[model samples]
Structures are given as C-alpha cells and as structure tokens.
Target chain A: MNRKLISDQDLVNLYVSGQESALEELVGRHKSKIYTSIYLLVKDSYLAEDIFQDTFIKVINTLKAGKYNEEGKFLPWVLRIAHNLVIDHFRKEKRTPIVTNTDGFDIFEVLGFVEESIEDKMLREQGHNELRRLIQLLPEEQKEVLIMRHYGDLSFKEIADLTNVSINTALGRMRYALNNLRKMMNQKEYSYRQAM
Target chain B: MVQTFTQNDIIKALYHELPASEMVHLEEQLENDTEIQNNFEDLNVLKLKLDSLVLEPSMSVISSILDYSRSYKK
Candidate 1:
C-alpha cells in the first residue's frame, strides 16, 4: 500500500483494527509537529523529548483500550494530549513564564535556513526577527491565538473550541495581533527611514 | 458609498472568518481600495513569514518517540 495515499482517518482505522504498522505510520506522519508544539511550550529539549514519547504512549493505550473516539481531527487530538502533558509538566515543576527566549532557539535563525532566494531570504530573516520581537510584546491572549492559528494550522473555529472562547473572540484576537504587528512595523520603518 | 473598513475587518476577511455576504463585500472593496489591498498583502506576507517560522523537531526526538511507542507492546 502506498503510504502516501493513506489518509489519517484510514491509518487511524487501520490502527484501531489491530494493524501495528498502521500505528507506526500514523506516528511517523505527525511526530515532528506534535513534538515541536510541545517543545515550543516547554522550551527544554530533553523534557520535550520525554513528553513527546509519553504522548504517543498515551495515544497507544487509548487506541488499544478502545477508548479513542474520533470526535475532532486526529492532529488536534494528538496536540491536545501534548498540550496537556506540557501543562502537567509545568504544574509538577511549578515553572512560571512558560516559553522564554533565553536559549538560542531564536525562531528567526531557524527560519533563515529554510528560505531560498537571497533577497527574499534576507527579508524573511528580518521579518522573522521582527515578528518574534512583536509576538513577545503581544498580550498572552493574542500571542496564543497567533501561535495556535498560524503554527498549529488550526482553523479559527477549532482554536475557539480548544481555547473555550467564542469563534468571534478567536477571530478578534487574530485581528488584534495583526493590527498590532502592522503598527509596530510602521513605527519601525518610520524610525529606520528617519535614521537614514 | 465608499465606506471604509478598519484593519480588524481586513484581518477577519483574510482569515475567511467573515460571513459569506460580508466576504463578498470585502472582496469587492479590495478590488478598488489600494490601501485595503496593501493591507491585505502585508497581512499575507506576515502570515507566510509566521508559518515559515515553524521548525521540525530534531530526528532524535522522532526516533525516541518511535522507540517509546514500540515499547508499549512489550
């Protein structure tokens, strides 16, 4: 069977029907995104790695025990597990200020390696840095919406459902986030133009 | 009447969270309003830049996860 042709739902069904390989394939498909999401919250590579594994273990137990219902999308279900684990990790450690930029995990530097065009790449690098700085400045609500919507590729409706806010509230936060970014960009540009 | 939409309205339209009727109205406005069009483009660029910021987890993290998954059956 062409693994590429296998939809998430099909793979999930296969796993539920007792095919081990199907479970493996599903994990292969989604592990990075899940791990990255958790890591973003926890900000510790070793701890993130451990929680990533635990997430899969929990998924396996849930699926094998026949307790897994395909209520929402599979990815979000997996992500919610990871999110809960990160939250638990924080509770256990009593860590304040989840996700600090103290280490060298500058989002801009990581993204800089992925761009192709020279000028576009440079602009993207600059944009990445500026965006990161701007995101750090946003209030927590707006920041969470931006991360969940953009990084998680979650629909606004899904985000609202996850965050337990109204759909309009989720949309409003994203709006506020963008408007804030635009304002910051204009201010920065004006300052730069004046400097030149 | 050339009623002006605010930045928030443009953001809502960009995300496709607007109602169908309002979406059509916004699209029509975007066709003629350069400022709105510019804002749309900037929002788009910002979204792409943000999307590109996502980093894949290291290969070792993936391997550990697979190993951990396999251990569940043992």
Candidate 2:
C-alpha cells in the first residue's frame, strides 16, 4: 500500500521482491476491464470469469517463473492472455460459443415496450443491455476487433498482429463492424447490407 | 449522398489513424458533407454503444480468482 503511486511495472518488481500484496494491487487495477473484455467476447459470464481466473493464473505462473519482461503495460499483456484463452476454448469446443442470432438482444423483445414514464435509470440499463445484445450479433471477426479495440483497449496494429491479419484488414473489420451495427439499428426501416 | 473519404478513410479518421493534414481535411469535408457526416456518426455511435456496456464479473468471481492466483504456482 505504501507504493500506491508506483507503476504496474513497479508493482511487478515488488511482487518479485516477495511482496504478495503487489500482485493483489496489480490484479485489482486491471480486473474490471479485463473481466469485461473477456465477458464481451465469451458472452457467458461463468466461462468468461473462469477464463479471467485462468488468465491471471497464467500471469502469476509466468511471472513466478521469471518470464514477464514487459514493464508498465500489464493490462495489455493480461488481455492478450485472456484473448488467446477464449479463442482456445472456442476451438476446443469446435464452435464459436458467443455467436448467437437470438432476439434476446432487443429491448422490445426482452421488456416489451416499457412506458415512457419509466425511470431514466431503468431505461438506460435496458438500452445498454440491448446494445450489449446487438454486439453479440456481430460476425465473429468484426466482434473480435471491436472488443479488442474498444474494450480490450488495443490499437488496430496490435489487433492485426494478434489476429494474424494485415492492418488494413483489421481496420476494415472495424469499419464493417460499425456499418453492421448501424444497419442492425435500422433493421426495421431497411434491410441489412451484406458485408463484402 | 456525397462520397468524400473512403470508408477506410473515415475509419482512420475516427480512430486517429490519419495523419494531421488528412484528419483536418476529413473534418473540413465532413462539415460540408452530410453523407460523410452521417457515416461518421454511425461509426462513432457504434463505438460509443460498445464502450458504454461495461460488464463486471460478480464478487464471487473476484474471490475465486484471488484464491486461485494466490495458491497457483509455476
């Protein structure tokens, strides 16, 4: 706690110096973002939480084995570890578990036209839930790029390298992702455009 | 609808991938181009919607991870 002003790398150094609480601080700093990133991808809270645990476990093991050389950017590294684990889980299951076309993502479908008089708080929550569902409806690659760039907080270059694609391809995926989401929004007014 | 920058160009602009002059040009053009402006809004809204949905794992999850990591070894 005395080293509150130090960087993640410094925390790592502290942990390396037999201060177990340093690891706790590092995990505390990153747990929310990291958890949300995995949850968005996996779409199953339980599995995402499991992967979250496994990710930090991997981090702990690697660091204990004296392998984490990156300083100051622990979250990205933690995210990379989580991302790969999610990919691996899907591959082993022989299907992308997160891809679903269910109507569960829509407000009208879920809550059936709430009165305009409803509290703004509840309305906002529903709106967020709807958007979250819509995100789940995106195609696998697009959704991956969206989550990595937006939630995982990686740049397109990092996303490109992580997915083994060209930078243009990564950027293109993001572009199409935005387009698809807009079309999904206008689904009632116009048919969705097929991606090229 | 006017076509100003390509979709990739708009993306680059939105995500700050464009260089300074290109970004300035895109902004200037978007000011006069409704089509490009709409496209920018679409992309911006998508990013906003996704960014707004912050999912937190439960406290039980936090406890489990903490316990696991503490006991975990190389």
Candidate 2 per-residue C-alpha lDDT over A1-196 given as tens digits, one digit per residue, 9 for 90 to 100: 5666879898998887767888878877777678878877877666777898889878888888889887777888889999999989988999866454342232222222346555865777767776777778888899889888877778788899999999899999998888888887788235425432
lDDT per residue, candidate 2, B1-74, as tens digits? 43357778888777777889778778889898898798788778777666667666666766776676567665
lDDT of each: 0.72, 0.77
**Model 2 chain A: ten consecutive residues of lowest lDDT:** A103-112
Clashing pairs in 2: none
Model 1: CA > 4 A from native: A104-130, A194-196, B1-9, B17-22
Best by DockQ: 1
Angstrom error of the Cα, residue A84, model 1: value is 2.0
Worst 10 residues of 1 chain A by lDDT: A103-112
DockQ of 2: 0.42
TM-scores vs. true structure, each candidate:
0.79, 0.80
Task: Report the C-alpha lDDT of model 1 over A15-76, residue by residue, as the tens digit.
Answer: 77867788778877776567556655555666777787788888888877778887547888
